[model samples]
Target: MLGELEMVKAVLSGSRRTVVLTGAGISVESGVPTFRGRDGSWKNYRPEDLARPDAFEARPELVWEFYNWRRESLRESEPNAAHLALAEMERKKNNFLLITQNVDGLHCRAGSRKIMEMHGSLWQIKCTKCTHAREDFSPLPPMPECPVCGHLLRPGVVWFGEPLIPGVLRVAIDEINKSDVFLAVETSSLAQPAASFYQLAKDHGAVTVEINREPTPISGFMDFALHGKASDILPELMAGLSE
Candidate 1:
């Protein structure tokens, strides 16, 4: 039997089109807390409480407070080895796509050109009363207003109960369908849509791989399950592709 690393290398060696799906675990090494973890709370409120459209509608100031804190916290966080390795993978592959659930913009900072931020981004803001939206990394006030409409501005993230940014799902599914190899990295495999991507790739005849710190619900489904820190495993995997 081939070793796990050898098996992964063999799969990548034959792959032409690859799609990668990532979640919060990939960013945890960069000091970002997982949404369901103990550190996800602030001022006696959970992330679920603050990251909702209703919460922003009722107390915009409080919502902004939480997001602003998150933004400031992430401002200094740099992409780890895993992120850089993925960027290198993108550069090497002719057809590569990175779909991430994280909103921190670390993938972009790491130089991954083909990316889909399924959950939206912390650096983007939109007007509540108009169609104006733009990226702004500057520190925001308690109640930032739209430059175009003066209406209250909100973080560009897909708040709970809100639909994903239009067309992101369609494009992601299209890529998954065309993938020759699918890698789920640092994901818990609990969230919807993304949780099912591995199965979709399998159905489409793609090799499925999972790289995570712990076993998840879908670990048994992957063709190869590599359990470890993504910052360590990803660089090693990418290095094997060159040999």
Candidate 2:
């Protein structure tokens, strides 16, 4: 049997249509905490609870408080080598696409241009009343209002009960359908929609690859599985590709 590196290299060779999906596990190396793991609690509140639309409507200030803290925490952390390597792959591949479930925006920071953020972003905010939105990381105070309509400002993200952004899922699906190789990086493959992507790609006759700390729910279905930290594995894979 080929080792993980050789397998990934072999899979990637001659592949012009590739899609990489990332999750919180990839961002944890940059000091950002995983949402469902160790950094799961904040002031006695679960992130899932606070990240809901009902919760935000109940207390927008409280929601902002948590988001602001999270934003500030990640503001200083730089993208790791894995991030840079992925960005390099994007620069080199003509038909490469990156789909990330992380809200931290590290993929963008790492310079991956063709990206789909499935979970929305921490640095983005929109008005409660209108649709006006822009990238703003300023600390929001009590009753922070929208600039356009003077309404409350909320983090631009897919809340617990909300649907994804209008066109985002379609883009991801389209990419997966057309990709010859689909890499599921650092995600548990348990989350809905995103969890279904690799399987969707496989059904469409694409080679599905899994790179994570452990075997995920979809591991059994993947054509190639590599169990390791993305920080360590991704760079090595990229190196092999370049060689």
Best by TM-score: 1
Estimate, for each residue in 1-243, the C-alpha lDDT of model 1 and write its tens digit: 238978897788778999999999999999988977877689889999999999998998999999999999998899999999999999888899999999999999999989999999999999999999999988899999988889999999998898989999999999999999999999988888888999999999999999999889998999999999999888888875852
Off by over 4 Å in 1: none
Candidate 2, residue 98: CA error in Å? 0.3
The per-residue C-alpha lDDT of model 1 at residue 142 equals 91
**CA lDDT for candidate 1:** 0.92
Candidate 2 per-residue C-alpha lDDT over 156-199 given as tens digits, one digit per residue, 9 for 90 to 100:
88888899999999888998999999999998787899989988
| TM-score of candidate 1 on Cα atoms, chains taken together | 0.97
| CA error at residue 112 for candidate 1, angstroms | 0.7
Please, what is the TM-score per model? 0.97, 0.95
